[model samples]
Target: MAITTDKMEGTVKKELHVFYVLDTSGSMSGAPIGALNDAMRSTVEELRKKDGEKADLRIAVLEYNSANRWVTQGNNGVENLQDFFWTDLQATGLTYLGGALKELNTSLSRNEKMKAETGNKVPVVIFMSDGYPNDDWQEGLQVLAENKWYRAAIKIAFALGDQADTEVLAKVVGVTKQGQIVPNYEAVIKTNDLQAFSNMIQVVSVSASLAASSSQMLGTEVGAETIVREAAGEGANTDENGVVIVDATSAGGDIYASDATADDLDGFDVI
Candidate 1:
């Protein structure tokens, strides 16, 4: 898909930037990568369906393995949802999460990708990873933490499967609205089921976008807590055909469980 660079100008609508930081490491080479691709395509499609008049929703996708790359590189690394396109990402190499974090920090700057424009809403950053970082992720996170936008942005993380390090994810998604530098473990949703992972991606993305876009008008804080609470609510009423969402805090392990006939192994392709 071609990456477009045009931005909507002279519009009264507020801009809601949604950043997706994805892990495409060697460990995600098979089924995990496939599920991620499917989920992202669906999520973007749903976001595009939203009323454009409400908010000028923008999306940025950053994928990291041994190196980090922007899938949506035009328009200061973010593009309007209506113009953005999804290209399937291949998984390989180590998980260089630290590098990705540093790159994200650069983009979040007002002098760079995130411009200081009127009607700019608080950005929403969603991170997904299935393994521990092989680089100095904490240092990169520290640099990001110093950014005003990073501190105020609505952050959420997904620990995909047992191999994922929830503790690390907790640190990345720090306390929302609170000035203290504390990890928000409640913001990390751990799931082993590929179907459920895919479903949760959409649920969280849609819910966060809706909440963040209108948060200022509602006089509420747009944070991971709001997103996680909405996701848990959706999970409680998930249909039989849908995957059951569980909270990692309550489940003590995985955040999703399914009794569907499909074999768990079949959900992820062996590379």
Candidate 2:
């Protein structure tokens, strides 16, 4: 639950940061918020699963609804999150996506230079919504694209239902990759299923934690493990036991790292 030791010293530590930007507008009142909550709770459960060492992760969230009331708006809103565990947020106000994003950009860009020399990587952003911008969001998106803050972090956008602007979501995805600015983004269009959306974010969070850990082992200064819970699943962690050897795989022409080299995930089907 805390940063114990420095895996790498005197280097720029790469870190994985994710921001769950939820739209609490009018439409997301019933099923949407409910599903979001369940999925979020499950995500926390899964990510806490141990794989040898706890995967370091720093997560924050922004809940924007009712042009007047922003249900959530903290890059690291876990303090509030711990007190509440549901995602079915109410939809009340006009979506101030631009204002919300500007808040996020400012939060990420605050100590930009400190990360460069210290190896702090940029945080990833997951923009989830069911409709187009009700406010001036173009500028906020533009700042994200043009500003060179934590470019190493990823920025993803998901449209919960059919109401999202496909073009915009795709464009933002590519623009947010670290080092290499990814101008092409791939967003999931099935917003009706908040369970699946939450699932994807869960995988992303854990994977990013692994990537961040790898970067730290290589010696960089990303975040110093704000909080890392032990394995939270029922079955003991097979990955962390060391009995399950993690070796690089080279099947066909594809190559995978030792830690996540899965030729096939036994139980689930990849969609």
User: Against the true structure, whose TM-score is highest?
Assistant: 1
List, residue by residue over 76-95, the lDDT tens digit for candidate 2: 34322233344445567667
Best-performing candidate as measured by lDDT? 1
The TM-scores of all predictions, comma-separated, are: 0.79, 0.60
Candidate 1 clash total? 1
Clashes of 2: 29
Error of 1 at 45 (Å): 0.6
For candidate 1, write residues 1-271 as lDDT tens digits: 6655575354577788889999999999899999999999999998888736567788999999999999997688888787777889999999999999999989987777676365577788999999999999988988887778888888888888889987788888883444345777767777877777777788788777787445464544466766675676534432232222354332322343442335654666634
TM-score result, candidate 2: 0.60
